[model samples]
Target: MIVTAKQASSHCGGHPAMNSAKPTLPAQILSQTPSTSSITDRLWRHSLYNVLDQQPLDRVNVLGDNSHGHLSCVNTLSWTPDGQMLLSGGDDRTIWRMDPDYDVDYPFVCKSVIQTGHKANIFNAHLLPHSTRIVSVAGDNQVRVFEAAAALAHSQSEPETTYSIDQLDCRVLRCHTNRVKRIVTEDSPDLFLTVAEDGSVRQHDLRVSHTCGPGGSCPAPLIKCQHELSALALSPLSPYQFVVAGESPYGYLFDRRNTGRSFDEEWGSLPPTSGPSIATCVRRFGRKTKPRDDVYGTHITGARMSSHNGHEVLLSYSGDAVYLYSTRDNPQDEDEHHGSSIIPSSQEHRTDVIPIASDESHIDVQLAETNDNEASSPLQRATADQGDLDGSDSDDLTLDAMPWDDPSVPIILPRRRFAGAGNVETVKDVNFLGPEDEFVTSGSDDGNFFIWHKATGELHGIYEGDGSVVNVIEGHPFLPLIAISGIDSTVKLFAPVNHRSEFSRIDKQEDIIRSNSRGSGQLMTRGQLALIRAALSGQELSEGNPCNVQ
Candidate 1:
């Protein structure tokens, strides 16, 4: 069962109970008592101790309001390396640095606000690791860098004061021709990467002017994809390897070392003699067919590498489902010619647009088959074939031996499918939670966030996060805390509290999965999304309102 703030408060009379007290390690467990269990068993036991403590029902603080907080929907929420400060970017074109441990009546308070000069919505903003510098991207197709200290210094007298882009030390880099979707930092503090709707993945070097290449001439991108990209994930274990997915049914893994000059550099330019810059591996989950214009369930919204297991990946599909896959197996073992670089052919470029059922009937049939083959227990089911979980198939392909034009590359299936999370209405984020990264969590369009056991794929908890939709689910770097934001103007922080009841697990899995699949037919256009943002910001729609369908 999902619990909201109003329902929780009503359960304890008219007054809401004080639920800010944090949980502590039991004395017996802290004493290091001898146990016969193996090291792995003990470690797993300890990690799962308070894994479900962070619940949205017990909201510790709400960080936005009409007067001081963001006037629009908060799109991104991230924590500094030190975990002392939280940063949030929104449609309001502002980035706010928040202190979650403030001493005032409210625990979370906006310490500083950077009013960016981007002509469009701020998609993402994050502080550079171990530095005061901040990087942000927006729909204006520009990447901006500013100093957090400068924003704070300017707002010292008035915490709620907004620091305009001109007043603060900032650098605006106009690199991509289209809107930038995501930006990620590498191990180097001076290096960062961005993917844009222009189908280019470019790397930026902070040490140089114009960020990449030389002077002001248009620098070539590292990799120019055939389709517009929306998601990018750098592998935690390999510095040169990353995953890029968007507008496509598959996620491509590429190595930066193998990248050649941008395809846009010269028309009909031949690939390097060494090899074409192509994905080393490709991952496909769900049905192998092209989605119709009305249903974009196959396009990837986000991709993330597991913090603990680099070979493991989590992908969230637009208006569809979430999947977890492993890339540990070598495709070369199956075929001698695997892993060779071949130019994509025209035939390979054309994806088969296989039509599917219009409603939940198809999903019901898939779910029924899944239940028929269920394992004896949750643990056994997790180890069993993952294809049945989402009622969708999975495949992994190594691209070395096949030409890019080949319709078939390779096929490894996903290890797990996180079910019952509805993501049909909005773009949501999926992430791993807990100290050991033992739990998988995602924001849903139903205004609640869902949590699953990382290893078992069991639906563990579902907590109400927003009144409309929950889009971002960011866990604190070290602490047992979670920060969530979506259509609501405020960012909600969740932490463990004693008064909250244990999380209610879903018993009827089929019902929830069916509910999640029911809305797959509805399509949310870009104009509709903008209207939602405008309504949240209390702004009147005018001739300037975006009307394009995504």
Candidate 2:
């Protein structure tokens, strides 16, 4: 997050470029073109998603495999305000913090197992709507609240450090009746939601004086939906409007002020079923209405919205396929989470809310420091960094393949801090890409970069790729560039080639469109021609002899 120049290189042992003097903005905004573009980093063979960012991007962040301790898969990721530290949760049922400091000889190498409470794979980890405290859910059917003070409060000298993720671990909040598949926060820090495998969704209000703190009882949820909830998220645009992903392959979006059952329950909800391969339940976000109608019950295995960006767009990823839709168009299924609901008690359905408490202090102490050296290093350094693959090839000989090629990785979860009208965007299982507005990008199982349209569900541009799937994709906000990790074991940067001259193409396209449009048809198909004339009519493009043909 904080990029500095080589002010004092010797004093800080880091890559020369690592010490950037300062984040320098271009004297003039640059232009972008498909051909004449500039790219910065390439995470080859590391690409896990098939999505990518727009022009002028930077590899501001990078998260590697476990350095503190190894985990099966990374299921959740969250960023700090400064964008410096990244938090993650996964199948290992462990949580961690990743600080990408290029100055350090090795990054992600200096990590801490962090919260050590959940007994099973951590289904989700998140920061409260407006505060620093994080909430994590697990398959163990428990939910725990972890305040930041507790994480940074660790002192090996203290008694808490005795437990380790690898050794005798304990610590974490466990308050749920079934496997917590996912969790999400609402507009107020006190308000949040979590879904479990037990076919239910619980809404929690810190104000609810439940014994969470002598704070009375965490009020019985304002609502409860009896559908088996899988994934959960609060709409970035309108906080009250939230989304939930479930086991039925479809998710739901309902206004907090609306009905008792969530969209998932109303649409021929499925009976709780068990499976080994169903990691996706149903997730949705993005509040901006779209130009078209999204057929109800869109069976999206996975969905994510763009952060801070204005277009309330969401992407849905199914298997090898991906679909993009806007919040407006998907109205039939566009219900709001006014609150949660409760199903009446029945012989088979009657279940008591089971709450368990784990010793989190223990998981943190034992996980200790990273056991291996620089495991974060590229696969090329295999001699020093071996495992996962058994070939005797040296690290240098091993190509960093695209991470998305594998069916295991997840669609990075979006952030909850940003508040604005968002365009709903969804993608089923398109390997890479998180739910941020501007800096978000994704790589597909097929080799291509699905650059998002700033705030809309449109494609900014497309980047061809290697034969393997594409995954690891990221972008920096301060600079005009991005990086992608692919199956080729390489990271590629996409930058603007002719920063100044590329603007010329925009003018060229406008001119071409002005020469073609005669009238608006029954349904105006969005295109270059429509946009050019619209801009000209609005007098926003400039007065003189418009985009000159010559």
Candidate 3:
């Protein structure tokens, strides 16, 4: 079912609006004179309404323990359906349900903590919609569902309750062979989707028994990508469609209906088969400037479909800038136009396809050999062509001079490009912000949240979030508040407030972009980066007692 804005707003509490009630003046003023009191009350009410209409874009609160909350970095933050609490998962193999209580000095308070019984770090976690169950994925290559009703009930009765996986009713599904990277829930609480580094995308149904699968395991994957998968996003407009991105530079759109099973049919089937029923790729998204042979440092870190516009998709690329793409045509029409799978195969000669934003930009892709002797990296070469880092020189190669610039080369570019955010060393998530999803926001390796105007691609604002890298930036379901987390143990909250301490704004956009471009070429492993981060944090380490950097 297509989810409308009104339905979404209703699901969350309705968005804050102006109260029609007139403000009451002080008793002393009311007793002194009726005319003065009446004018003062109307003016106060008008002023309050104006403030509520403005955007809430200021850092207001930090949520975590005074010493340290999670022993490691927090990876993800998700808001509950009612927007009353936030669910956060981290490398410490723990999930905290926090209440943003404005009544206290420390507004963000952890009401409960769930110790996930995973063998490794927790990657992502979320409270499923229309249900009280919480689904989580971690480095253990398994999906776990926690019956959170009891835990949540305990927390409401007595705050700060701690529950172990064994203490609560839970189910674990061993489906993936490698680390699971992401999970997304559907409209129905029974169905959900997960993607892993094993290159498998699988759908799970809580109502089905797994006895039919091989060795009594979960069902087979619907899509086995050639590249390791990292991110997944379900379309709000289309129930059976979703998008997936990974180590490859491009994002692939797939339709589950192509498997010959409708949503209703899949739900009605009592026993599921063990055989794999794969979906079809409908479209591919990528930049026109990307090189044919160079896939290094081009892996997508995050992919999100805009709730305000399903035709638009936002992507964050490691060692690069954020991009916004517009799927200009219907999925069925594009599927027929492309007429073939965009998946990479072992064949030496194959057609490379990309989504065309408009009819005027249509182009066919032909295989072309890249120069192996080029010393500079793809990022450096692209930046150098614009000019020197200082923006002065001109003799560099132009887009028309590039090998992929031929008329036969298939190329599609992004609708908007947002720069000035550092994404060189970490896997960061990008998202749309504001009540209407009017702004694009992402966290940087520099520990700051960067926002840009979605329509114009102009930098809007930047706020400090964490001490190291800010990996996640999630907007409130209906309100203007935002929750951000990173290498730090705490989650920082941003909202519109009348009073805030003065902070510096970044004015060196070109410098940040250049630095990110240089760092992208010198990438480091996650383990290595973790070690450096620990050292910078002044943690004590020894040969036998090393920090759990994972």
Over 339-444, each residue of candidate 3 has an lDDT whose tens digit, in order, gives 2222222232222322222332232222234436442553344333222211222122111111111122232335566776788767888898754567888888
Off by over 4 Å in 3: 1-56, 66-68, 102-106, 155-157, 211-214, 261-277, 290-293, 329-412, 499-504, 508-511, 524-550
TM-score of each: 0.71, 0.46, 0.71
Candidate 2 local lDDT, 1-550, one digit each (tens): 1011111111211122122422222212222112211232122211211223323322222333223232354455554433344455666656654433333322222134554556676656765756646677777777766555444333323321222333422233334557886666655677677766654556665553334333333323322344334555455466655555543223444455442334543574531222121122222332221112121122333445444432243434222123333444322231222111111122212111112214322221111123344444321221221221122222212121111112121112111111111111222222224333442345544445545444333334445332354443444332233444344322233443323221122223222222211110111112222233444455342222210110
Q: Candidate 1, after superposition: displacement of residue 152 in Å?
A: 4.9
Worst 10 residues of 3 by lDDT: 1-10
lDDT of each: 0.59, 0.36, 0.61
Off by over 4 Å in 1: 1-57, 102-106, 152-158, 211-215, 259-297, 331-411, 501-513, 521-550
Task: Please list the residue runs of candidate 2 whose C-alpha ends up more than 4 Å from where it truly belongs after superposition.
Answer: 1-69, 100-111, 129-132, 153-175, 186-189, 207-227, 258-298, 309-315, 329-440, 443-449, 454-550
Minimal lDDT window, size 10, model 1 = 1-10
Residues 1-550, candidate 1: write the lDDT tens digits. Answer: 0001110111111122245454332212312333423686446444644645443335555665555577778888877755556788888888877653222222456656777887898877777765668889989998888865665443323434467767767888787878898888876667888888876677777775533223444445666665567787775577577777776556666566644445643665432322223333343332222211222224677888765667777888776567776666443232221222232343443332223334423321121123465566543443343443332321222111111212444444355667567777777778888766688888877777888888777777777778888899988655556788999888776655556533322444445455555554354444334444565566764432111111
Per-residue lDDT of 461 in model 2: 44
* Clash list (residue pairs), candidate 3: 364-410, 365-410
